[model samples]
Target: MREAAVSPSPLSPSPLSSAAAPPARPVRSPLSGRLAGLWAAAGARCALPVAVLLALGFLAPLVAIFAYSFAPPRSFDVFRAFSLANYAELFSPSNTVWLSFAWSIGLALFTCAILAVVAYPIAYGLAFLFGRWSSLVSVLFVFPLFVSENVRLYGWVLFFIKNGVLDGTLKWLGLEGAPAVLYTPGMILAGMVYTYLPFMLFPLTLGLSMVPRDLIDAARDLGANRFQIWREVEVPLAMPGILIGMLLTFVLAIGAVSEAKILGGQSVIVISHDIEIAFTYAQNWPLGSALAVLVTAFIGALTLLVFARLDLDRLLGRR
Candidate 1:
């Protein structure tokens, strides 16, 4: 067997060399790799400044308020002492602050309902009927916002006060004197509706604008009546804007103080007024902080619930 061994030719390849070799990978410089990573993250890096600004401007105050909320009632020793006394006091049976909460919530609800009904027609006109004049009408609506809210509210006070413009005009016209409608809950609600009407109208208009006219025409072609189209198509499409308008109106109305003060006088007390009293007149910082915390929590929870049901991608037109 040793004598039978044969010599291999130089052209013949070995078994190991018969298979194709894998290509060597190109090595990149560390600096280039680092630059690539930085470029990829450029957007997030750019956002850092805004994030810092928000943390400072918005979150910092919330953190302070939250910390103060747990402090002992009627004390400014924030972050030094922690107690549930403020909350306990608010929850106590004798506390009539609940009445203030009820008033604020009820007034806010009424304002929202009124604004929804009143703004819808106007919003519809703005979206579909006003045509080229829409911008002018919108500007007119926005013009009121530039004036001070307090000034506007005070003007209403003068107009509605006894022997003011209405009463004087009525008497001059040989008609019965104007009814004593000032300094009433009804007046406060009226003021709120007036103040928050624009907020509701604009959002509703935006939502209505999102609805495609072609789809509406198609629905009509399909024998869908006006009510059916509105219920099945328009409402579903414009829901985001409607919800946004309602939420904005509700939030502003719930925290209203000037309306109650300037119009309702002492007829009604809202939660915001109570908080102001706690912070200013009563000098109860903890109590104010607690009230603020509760209000914020309620709003946050409601907002979350709304957002949970919202199709954000659809609203944003990402889809």
Candidate 2:
């Protein structure tokens, strides 16, 4: 109203010359700077022991196995002379190793599949059936490990022998005969299933317990049938346990020499047996090492392919 000359707005900073001015920096004390440095140092120091252990555990053993694989067949004393003769003999048709390995792979696959089917129901019971009995059931499943592998194998031997349970049952059933299950591949699979069933069950129970009941119900309400719920909802969610159990069961079963040697009557010639024969009976460490390495490489490749194909995280769950 007075018509006085208007001055620049007091609150507005002049952008013409002040555009280059920096904003206020965060305040930091010398003590705070020292503390930041100390925190980083502490973290690094804490990590050192773990790093050392990993180097010893993960790297050292792998390096030793690699060295052993390439060692000379004639003498273990030789260093890095580089020979493929052991590998050549390994793949030879006369060895029966290829056939043996194929059989072993078959047994492992069959065992894993059976265990998966058997364990799913048990896990389902533990998750949905047992309730207050869940802890007892889980304990019962784990309790058998205290029996020892040798004892477990021996027990199967007793059960499968000519006059064992099945034969006894046959005698009672008026058939008066059941062919001996002992020393057979079927016996081997039974033992495999008995021993490793708990592995699949425990993990699967853990997986199932994690999946909410409401989620299953919601899917069902939306027209998801029992098969669809399992295939789409339950399986996807429980994939971590299933995949882990499958891998463990398969890998361990494929490497099984004990069940075959002890219960299957040593008639079974598996890859593990091949490795053993090369070392024990043949006294050819180099050949054994090479065969071992080859089998290991094959399994390692298969595991990688399976994990990649399945998208491992789907099994691991969303963290």
**In terms of TM-score, which candidate is strongest?**
1
Q: What local lDDT does model 2 show for residue 292?
A: 74
How many Å off is the CA of 120 in candidate 1? 0.9
TM, every model: 0.89, 0.83
Give lDDT: candidate 2, residue 310. Answer: 63
Give lDDT tens digits, candidate 1, residues 44-97.
Answer: 899999999999999999999999999988888998999999999999999999
Worst 10 residues of 2 by lDDT: 310-319
lDDT of each: 0.92, 0.83
Off by over 4 Å in 2: 1-37, 40-45, 78-80, 164-178, 306-319
Q: For model 2, state the Cα shift of residue 136 in Å.
A: 0.8
